[model samples]
Target: MMLLLMLIADLLILSVHGWIVYKTTKIECFPNARYIRNATCGIKAVNRYRSHTNMESDIVNKLRNVSLNLQIFLRNSANKFKPFLVNVTANLCSILDKRNFPAYTTIVMNILKEVSNVNHSCPFTHPLSTHQQKRLIVKNLYMDEKFMPIVPPLGLYKIDFNFLEGYPYDDVGTVILYIQVTDVKEFKLRTKAPKFVYSTIIYKTLSIECKYNPEILTNVTCQLKPINWQKSVCIWDADIPHSLKNISIHLQLFKIYGANNFLPFLINTTLNMCDVLSKRSFSVYGKILFTILKETSNINHQCPHEEHLSLYNLYVDARLVPVTLPLGIYKAVVRFLEGYPQVFIGTTVLNLEAMEKRERRGKVNKN
Candidate 1:
């Protein structure tokens, strides 16, 4: 009888523990910057809540010798806030390089990696141009409970980020973030969804231009026309010579820095067009190219001695733009080659721009 009673007790204990674990869904941490102040020349600091729960910080200008002082305050029983946890000051540059204070540094790096274009290395340099600045910061902001290296006890907590610069450590800015931790059951019963905003990256194409060699691919025609104020279509008609076999394509991307100067940004790579078309090999760049052109063009089948190849009224699908490219003029140079020697058959230079997407309120507006 005593053994049976002990078994009942064990079952009850296991059920209770399981219930507790199941109820604790996730840790809820939200951020809010109360104020931001910058007292240096050629620097701008702004902080505001983009939504009810998402906070955004926009700091323009390069940063060097930056130090960060972090403090955590907890609400106490006496209805007062007191320092209950960490209070440490560390050089931001050193943390980026050597990863000091790993517990805290991990959080900082995770946040920056998600929201901003700041490099993971030291001596942080952000985009300076107006269009580049617009693309640097993204709106989606939320901390996954699993990402936290260590979760504090459930309570109301305030975190202060004090930024300092130079040898004397002159104050650069301060940003305060508030956090609340609650049981998953309570969170679900009280909230409709996770108290975080998520959005997809959107971009608009400005222009496109293409060029090719007349001797190799005769009767070549390329044109871009505006379908509407916000949309455009590209048309290309080229005659491929019968002798051209085992073709390859080289793609290079350049971004305009200032004025009309275009500097190399990404992708100076070559791919075998025949392999891509014959489904023998599918590379990352090839997949992207196929995704963009598959729906509107007739370049899906295997390659050999070709006839005529054409793309008719091909629209640049904004959704197909895989990454968040900075707003500005961009040049894509595509070179078609023939045989193993890579004799250049044709060259096409495409000029385009990535622009911010405008919100649709009443009438559609262009940005």
Candidate 2:
């Protein structure tokens, strides 16, 4: 009986040892591979667990496939809605309540970032000139890959600009925000040559009461209009100041659109600057003398246009008109001139070398 008990004890020890080894080496099977961890089950139930695990994996795969397909569908739908998105982004400020200006601005900026290709380069720094054929290539300011993982669909984007530090007065130039959008469908054409588009610019005032007055432009309302349209015909007008009667101030606004057309329309003067310069157009004008020999004894001559005194006639240059001005920036302020209520036309920088002079010296030569 004692011998039999010893043998039973030895068998029990072997079984426990085998069970511990099996538990340590057990392979855990999960329906979803993501949930697999430490697992131990007896050999008898291994096949049963695997059967359930396979079914669970199949179900997880099907769900994953559905999720992937849904993602693709949403992306395609967003592409279709991209153009409308751009319009909505541009018109956000118009639709939002006036009181929620901060929120409206934030949303618009976020939308712009989502749609725009991020470009960290400095703003374009070309001084706008009216005397030359000005051609500009409008593109995104930033094109960061992290901000823009996918390229936005090609379409027309309406860019809005404003000043950050409020409207600057004369002598201190204003810093205007420059926002720009490019065409989407015309990308191929844009790649070859820039295409122009027409858009409306609505001027506003700082307050609702000042809406009727375009002159009181707040930082938000003050922005330069895009120059993509055809050039306007410039008509020079004569302005005689009370102080200087002889000196004629040539008032000419930088190209007024729709004014030259057959249709009678006034330019949006609030957005324009009717510059006044001291130079006279008469200086550029020339006169010529003409003589014709007639078949008869009498000679006939016709002068082309009005003739001005020339060097041939020993005409002396007109006496220099000296108009004394203080050492300060001077601008001709013309108000209510363009039919707009209180429209103020101002001049930009008129540099004078005599008043503000700087001496230049060559770098010290090392002998």
Candidate 2 lDDT tens digits, 3-80 = 111111111111111011101112122222221112221112232111111100111110110000000001123443
Query: Which pairs of residues collide in candidate 1?
Result: none
Backbone clashes for every candidate come to 0, 9
TM-score of each: 0.44, 0.15
Angstrom error of the Cα, residue 8, model 1: value is 60
After superposition, which runs of candidate 1 have C-alpha atoms over 4 Å from their true positions? 1-205, 359-367
TM-score between candidate 1 and the true structure = 0.44
Model 1 residue-pair collision total: 0
lDDT of 1: 0.52
Local accuracy of candidate 1 as per-residue lDDT tens digits, 238-356:
88776566889888777787677877554466778888777776565676677665777777666675678888777656565444455677788888898877677877777776665
